[model samples]
Target: MTIDTQSQRAEHSPLRRIFGSVFAILQTRLELIGIELAEEKDRLLGVLFLGLDAMMLATMALIALTALVAIAFWDTYRWQSLAGITVVYAIAALVCALKARNGLVNSPIVFEATLAEFEKDREIFRKP
Candidate 1:
């Protein structure tokens, strides 16, 4: 009887309860992190495929347009027309590169929600 009673008391001890609560919180946070990671992965893959498709189409259009422009000025100013087109393309490439750099630099942090949840947990634990 005494052994059974002690066992029951130990199972329902405050320390055990605290540990269980902490484990539950950790499990919930881990699940949240997993969900956020999956979402980010999906978003990144979508952007990657769309961006590649757009770039391919744009490159085809630009090539066709460049050929047309060069043919239009072939007899009179062939070299000059090609040079002008090359310069314009170079400038546009530079602008796009700069914008891409800025976008990467300014992009939101990954796992933002996970970090926030951890911070909240820290705050909760810090209180008496």
Candidate 2:
């Protein structure tokens, strides 16, 4: 009975070790995915807040400047001044929108490191 038990354990040991290694690798990959997700979320939030603040301040400034320009030209070129300001604001808005679209389209793939790590794991396991 003692000899049989020793043989059984010896036969199962390699399987157990393989399973342990696989589980460890899986756990590490999961941790890396979690970390990447957190970083991406923080970055997106920061960009959102900063963009909102910039838009808000820029709008306030534009409104104030528009009022000042209109008041300054109230006698002679009031209409032309307002129309020019409107045209300039429209062009600026279009440029900003295009830049934002390009930024989103060109942004790096999310979880790139996690994908690379998974690829490495696949390569490691594929070896003979």
Please name the candidate that would achieve the greatest lDDT relative to the true structure. Answer: 2
**Superposed Cα deviation of residue 104, candidate 2 (Å):** 0.5
Model 1 root mean square deviation, Cα atoms: 2.0
Model 1 steric clash pairs: none
- In the predicted model 2, the residue pairs found to clash are none
lDDT of 2 by residue, 1-128 (tens): 99999999999999999999999999999999999999999999999999899989999999999999999999999999999999999999999999999998999999899999999999999999
The stretch of ten residues in a row with the least summed lDDT in candidate 1 is 10-19
Query: For model 2, how many clashes?
Result: 0
TM-score of 1: 0.90
Q: Tell me each candidate's RMSD, in Å, in order.
A: 2.0, 1.3
lDDT of 1 by residue, 10-70 (tens): 8789888899999999999999989999999999999999989998998998899899999
Best by TM-score: 2
